[model samples]
Target: MASDPEDRAAAQRELASLKFAQAQDKAKQDPAAAEKLVRESLTLAPGDEKAVDLLGRVIHAQGRLDEAIQVLGEGDGKSCDMCKRYLSVLLLERAGKREAAKDFEGARTDYSRATELIPDATTALAVARSSEQLGDLEGMTRAIEKAVPLIRPEDTAAQTEFLGFRERTVLAAAGRGDVATCDRWLNFFPPGAGGDGWYVLQLRVAQELYRQKKVDVAVTRARTMLGSTHTDTLPANRKTEFQRFLADIYRLQGVGYLREGKLAEADDNFRLAMEFLPGDDKIKLLRALAIGGHHETEKALQVVKALPKETKGHAEVMAILESMQVADRLAEGDVEGPRPRSRAQAASAETPEVHVAMAEILFITPAAGVNKGIVRQLKKSGIVKYPNDEVNRYGEALSELAWAREQARGLGEGYLFRGPGIDARMANLDRQLRAFTRSRSSSTPTARRS
Candidate 1:
């Protein structure tokens, strides 16, 4: 019997296979009996992958997870597919038990091993969740990435579960101000997977970007979300809040540009802000300041003058208007005075009729300066009879008209400044100036003509 080692080895292998078959049959009915049989098989054929896998499963069924993991892990899982599959299952069971005991590191390690063996969505997601529990966001992200593509499209429940997990990760990342992690997880969220929580996360990211002085990136992100269909479907109040946030970003950008002396850029940003917050008086004031920075004092004055009377009365608004007026005078080379005449001085100096008549002369005349006819008209109106200082006279007429307009506005819409009134004439002048400005900036001949 001992003469031929080859025959003896074959007989032992046959016995081992028989024992393993019996172990498989009894594994569900009596794990204890199954474990005994699998052990016999492994002893007969040492290192047999099938016998090892069966032993691990029976041990696991008896709730000896650590022992089962050790038995299965001793086999060559890399070379034997059956061994790898069995080891993965046992590892998952052990990981869940570890998680229950608050052994997060052990659980993550076990889950990771299972995922490496199986590489399926279930195991991968398990690893992700375990990694999350351990506060290993980078590990969690990597696990989720692996799980996503492995999920079958028909398995909608799994997809939904994964999305929920991803959303949680995103919010968690945002809560800790982990911008890169937050953005990565957010990208993993499928369209429509992002509910209100998704928008909240996006807003948080945008706010963080703004705080970091990454204004352009923040603006782009917020603007894109604002225009998204998801945002359009939000509750009205929520949409308005989002819009206000974007408007604030734009306003801040405008202020930055103003400080840097980038007048055109500042004006453009404020205009965009107004689109979001059309009734924001503060933003409107900022736009006027930007225009004044461009040396377009009259245009800036027009914007300030058109504000609600209450806003016009604000000290800040008055200061801005006075600064623009002073800049206008300096541009006209009127540097003789220590300060421009105050609104009180202008109001005390002129009657309402005289101010209105002067406004009419300035409105009708060409930009080259007041001609002889216009001077006579102004003289008849009791302003600048000589017209030697045409620039100062024009500026004085504007200031007077501005003061008269404020007075008339205070008295209500029905109280006119005088014949033909300041309202109609001012409106006409604004329209003409706006048209002219547009003509100079645009390439279209029709726009220039209009």
Candidate 2:
């Protein structure tokens, strides 16, 4: 025991300071080596909060985050808000490591804890991204919503960036027809304060509402978006996006309902579709079918009756009129409904995905074959799958599938309804039928070989 207590106290402070300074210098060049100096500094003067925090960081720099967190926690016991919030950064960095490892669940947990502690934009974004990786869409939306208040009201760029992330997720989910996921995201960004995000989300909401057969709600949402004076970041060409996208939804629903023999519903949907695509002949034909199928013979007749005389004389119009007559005649007897599933309906079971992800990540650079982006963009532009593309570079897989299917269908009736030339043959027959009927009366069907 040194008889001088003052000397012992003075020695402890001096050593602690010297060791802490050395630790800082070493940390810049060699974090692992700095760990030793930082530990020594903490021991020289017990409960040195700064030394504890520094030691945590030094260890953390060496990728020992668990230990870093434990070490910092001890200091945090005596520290105030300053160092406590710093811990959230440590947590976020660690979560990134876990995310890189595809330990998404662990990353989500870490981000959740960090965001709960900090409740700020940085941590909230971490939470949202981690949740997206985990496919916890609800969690992702919740995290993004939590970030809204933290964003500066004047930072439109920041607001767009955050909402852009959500939009990607929303559109991707909707493109896959993941209705549950789309609807969950729609719960946020209703009208008001959200600005661009809210307007964009409404587009998806209306699309999904139509998919769900909530036609009125979907139409209302579309009309509201069309009417919104609020501007968004999308290009002006996309101004009619709500109407165009809703038209697609209505057409899809009309096709599905027509297949299901829900003629009345299909009629309404097709009518809604014409509001956006007034010239869509397929929509008009389908609406007539819907009316006739629903037993509205007069309404079904009225559709064809309303067509121009030249149009009424077209084969397509006559066919629809024939369908109406069949419905009227069948009014007296039981007519077997079509099978539970129809080919048209089967197509809508999943939304059409125009272009799949080029690479697992948006950009992948390897010193090898054609870049995935090139392939993806080519496919997106409909340049892939050409007869000349396969066996050379891109679209080899798709070409193989097409060739195999073509070869198999040639082998039997299983593919009787599908093939390359069958469409042309069908079209030829349709043309002949239309040509033959171009001069006939609406009541002058039943042409025979007499």
Candidate 3:
């Protein structure tokens, strides 16, 4: 081997030439192949700086960014500062290693060493975003301030990034109850032109207004947000929530109109809400429509009948439907439907409890509770007493009534007075049964008459 020095030297030169050619070919299209060539060249000549830089570039291109960092890491005093600084930044980003990325002080060291290594707006913006994601708000502010001078006025990306930062800052300030900071942030935004940020800010303001009981202002702000074309900027699910909020606004408006005796307007808004509402409570809108005489009560009942059976509103809605049928019958001089109105009337005519039960079942709300029909039935029975045996049967009815009351709570304040009427009807039913029993005993043959 010592005698073959010339031959070994010739073989090394040949190997170097082959690696250079392979690296050139790979550099055009394949980073992985380029990586292999550069690494091999470095292995043959361990002190070659060119081979090390080329290897770092290839690794960075292949997204093995950490490898690039390690390759360029050895060049501190031996190679140019520019390569090391650029390689470090790229390494941190590609690896999603923010701690390494924010080694800005370290980067500044290398950047200061390189004579023409000017820091640009894009670099600063990226660093700012990284800092923000890492919860380094002070660092973000510093980064943006440094980058601002390099950003041209027309640079849309820079503007957008800055606005996003501003939004986060405002939200953070609001969370901290720093009203002065929030107001400063708000001043940067004009009326309605800032896309989703505009709506978000308005929504926050509306919430504050609601908390302060500024109902009109809150409603106006909520309406403005939902009505904006940029409302579509919200995610599909959030858009649904906004729509529901808008519906709630309409519901409140409907109540206001009702209180003001603007029945037509109240009914219109309630109907509009029902049109957009997602669930079975649309019956409420229809009921409002009926009670307000927005259309004939008959028309509202028709709306109820048109709903599917599985809807949450079905039982109350169907009873409304039945009541309308009765109303229509009465309109034509027929007092009642095919079924008798009173249980005692039916019982006196030898009606079976099974049939009565079947008829009464329709009045039971699915979620449980009393209904106006139950009141009507007990009232017609002329019951005027309450006792232990009767109270148990009545408790079952009251349980059903309790469920109805729960359902009604969402309907609003007007129905609160109806509960007392229900209690009175139960008392009357007990009295009638007792009186009937007493009269039956008195008329027996072994009694006074006998």
Top of the candidates by lDDT? 1
Q: Tens digit of lDDT per residue, candidate 3, span 325-348? A: 332344465533463234223222
Candidate 3, residue 148: Cα displacement in angstroms equals 6.4
Give the TM-scores of the predictions, in the order they appear. Answer: 0.56, 0.48, 0.37
Better of 2 and 3 by lDDT: 2
| RMSD after CA superposition, every candidate | 15.3, 21.6, 15.4
Candidate 1 clashes between residue pairs 3 or more apart in a chain or in different chains: none
> lDDT by residue for model 1 over 1-450, one digit each (tens)?
267886998888888889999999999999999999989988898877777777877888888878887777764367466788888877887789898999988888988888888888887888888888887878888888888778886777767778778768766665565768777778775334556766776877777677777777777777777786665566666677778988887777676666556767877888988999999887777777676666665686678678775763334444444544543564466655544335523433343433443444454334566577865675554422332423233454566577766765675532211222124545554454345335434644554566
Q: Write the per-residue lDDT of candidate 2 for residues 268-318, one digit (tens) a residue.
A: 887888998788665665566555565564675577566654542234433
- Indicate the residue-level lDDT of 224 in model 3: 58
